[model samples]
Target: MAFKEGFVWGTATASYQIEGAVHEGGRGESVWDEFCRMKGKITDGDNGDFACDSYHRYSEDVQLMKQIGIKAYRFSISWSRILPNGTGEINMEGVNYYNNLINELIENGIEPYVTLFHWDYPMELQYKGGWLNSESPYWFENYAAICSRLFSDRVKYWVTSNESQCYIGFGYGTGWHAPGLELPINQVVRAWHHNLKGLGLAAKAIRQNAKGEVKVGLVSCGEVGIPASDSEADLQAARNVLFDRERSEDSIDFGFGDLFEPAIKGEYPKSLIPYLPKGWQEDMKDICVPLDYIGINVYIGSIVEACEDKKYRNLKLPVGIGKTSMEWSFKPETLYWVTRFISERYNLPVYITENGMANNDWVSTDGKINDTQREDYMNQYLSALSKSIDDGADVRGYFYWSLLDNFEWAYGYAKRFGLVYVDYSNYSRKLKQSALRYKRIIETNGEILI
Candidate 1:
């Protein structure tokens, strides 16, 4: 079989990355807003002040997705924009903005998959200890309840948060992301627990407040270990490294289980038990709420081999492997292994919520962006994904990492990862050739890849 019938083919974008009018719409300040102000924090001092101007031009964006035959659009809602302070009055303007965007998508025959949080924490909450505060779960629950009450009538697919590892580990543990703070391991663990609790609570709120049935899940990111060879030992080693609990302590290279175990299994891994806060066991009820699916944002993976001492060791890539403009190694099999591993472990349907590569694209002399490398990347990756399905991996869908070239977090706009190119100076959008290829793939329901 090729891809399963009714497989979702879509594109994704986050709020702060695309929505520009940050200061307007009665929007409150987010940690990212403050993070962008810190000197030397952002590359070339770039920020999201006017990212693609999507705030004023969302209609244009929806049309672009329609032109490319995107059936669904996965986007996030800015928390601070909805509740300026993260826990108080509702901002009608913010609600109206999302309403307009969602209505536009529905009018254009595109499904809307909403992510509640994508690392844009409210500045007011950050000052109050953010996720470290015991009340953070309720804060998120309140926000989620409002969203469900308002938009659930039209939006049915919901993701509570995107990549907790990056937000909690990199943002709090390593000081790499917004509200950057290099806290001790124990504090980081505490923040992670709070984040998980928030996810569970948010899921409950969505169910209780949704106008109708909804599919809820969490988006996680981590390494996917590929076996060095097809040997049984190597396959076991790859699986071991992907789920090992020891990797959780490394902050930057944790495994999916560090977050998924607590959220899905309702208890922290035994290795992490010591670092948990007091009364953490009582929080399991909320953390273990049932989920309809698991969302994973994958890009690259490393090779793993079985070691002599009954362990697995990840091998470093030698010189000359294909690399993206962001320097991420090109590994198409990562999509196969990640889906297979997650499906086998959790027994839940999987969706590749984000997968795409950055390319140093520019308007060529012919006035067209011929992103052939990205096109090839998509073909190879999707081929591997089809192989996984043929081997019994229950993958439900794939959403590309982005739809437009917006703010690239700390890397700024230097890296381009969009199917459609955005001229930074004029905010004009031009579809790369890969987009047309994708349109054909979507039109045929991935038959081209098969």
Candidate 2:
């Protein structure tokens, strides 16, 4: 595992997914807070009321990071917590909470990689049309500006948005998330433009408030479209599997109604732009502003080539391939190609910020979680990653999906992707087998053999 100097070894977590002080510390309501309140929207009618209590347990978490020999920590800041009303007023206490966190991370020798937004939209903003509103970009920039002024001093890396395609597409189309309004076809197109524009605008704002060479990364998730076999029929199917969330036909707006469009082409396939309110091209140019690097979140690759030949879009893929406890395909080879695809298409350096597997490792009688599945999965993927880097992929760093088992969003606590096993019943955390193995990997700089 020989590698160049300055490699980043870190763990990642989102604020809403972990921090449980939802209503405490002058925090305003977020869409997630509101969404979970709806009956049955979550797996077990569960809300993130006391999620790992990371808000109070961050010191312990940071200690866990140092114990694991990690050099960096990438986490998001809760929006509503900072701006309780979503605008017009700032909470000094909320700002103090984050300042304390950031300063503490730096003092403890951990680089802080902060994400401004991670799908936890302030509930107040949702009342005014959420992402669907054209003014959302202004709202986002305002939030970014405030964050920059406070923590930009210590933070060098900032990610503007986390997986725009997933949050926008799933939240609106699938009705799985907040601001639970399903809009008309044309409106959905507006939201897409607004989100991309808002992302770019946030970056611009952060740059304006920066005092140093602050770097920004945009996070997007993907699955490789694979063909069932080498036959031309199957191979062709692989080329057009556009059902991935980003490429999907689900939209409240008309333009991106096409199931999927290739990024290289530079034009969405929906062909509904005739209905736009005009100036969409300008907005897109803003959205395409230069980014220092793109953060890619890859779980597994899919066989797109398998779905094309059949009619009715009824591609019968199996329920199982390579799976974690969450049953997501854990193919790192897909990560290699997808990194190649986005880098070649956008011609930008990339970082994998979220990549890990979940396991059904039960607690042994001695109160230890021996998660060999997770350990093996990490090795398999990292090996593929090594191959990717060797093959000339411009990947700088890789942050494991998480540091510990915390609340898993809508999935509740059912799925665990942590290297450390957490006991929710008693709020106790124990390092699992994978954590021990990973510590050695980090300490040895990934030199340990598979």
Using all chains and alpha carbons, the TM-scores for the candidates as numbered come to: 0.97, 0.90
Let me know the TM-score candidate 1 reaches against the reference structure.
Answer: 0.97
- Can you write out model 1's per-residue Cα lDDT over 1-450, one digit (the tens) per residue? 257789999999999999999899999999999999989889999999999889899999999999999999999999999999999999999999999999999999999999999999999999999999999999999999999999999999999999998888888888878888898888988998899999999999999999988999999888888999999999888887666634445554456887788788776766777788999989999998999999999986989999996558878887899999999999999999988888988999999999999998988999889999999998899999988988889999999978998899999898899999999998999999889988988888788874
lDDT of 2 at 202: 89
lDDT (CA) per prediction: 0.90, 0.75
lDDT of 2 by residue, 87-206 (tens): 879888889888888888888899999999888899898889888888998999999998998888889899998876667766776677665656555566667668777887888889
Question: How does candidate 2 fare on TM-score?
Answer: 0.90
Reference-based lDDT, residue 140, model 1:
99
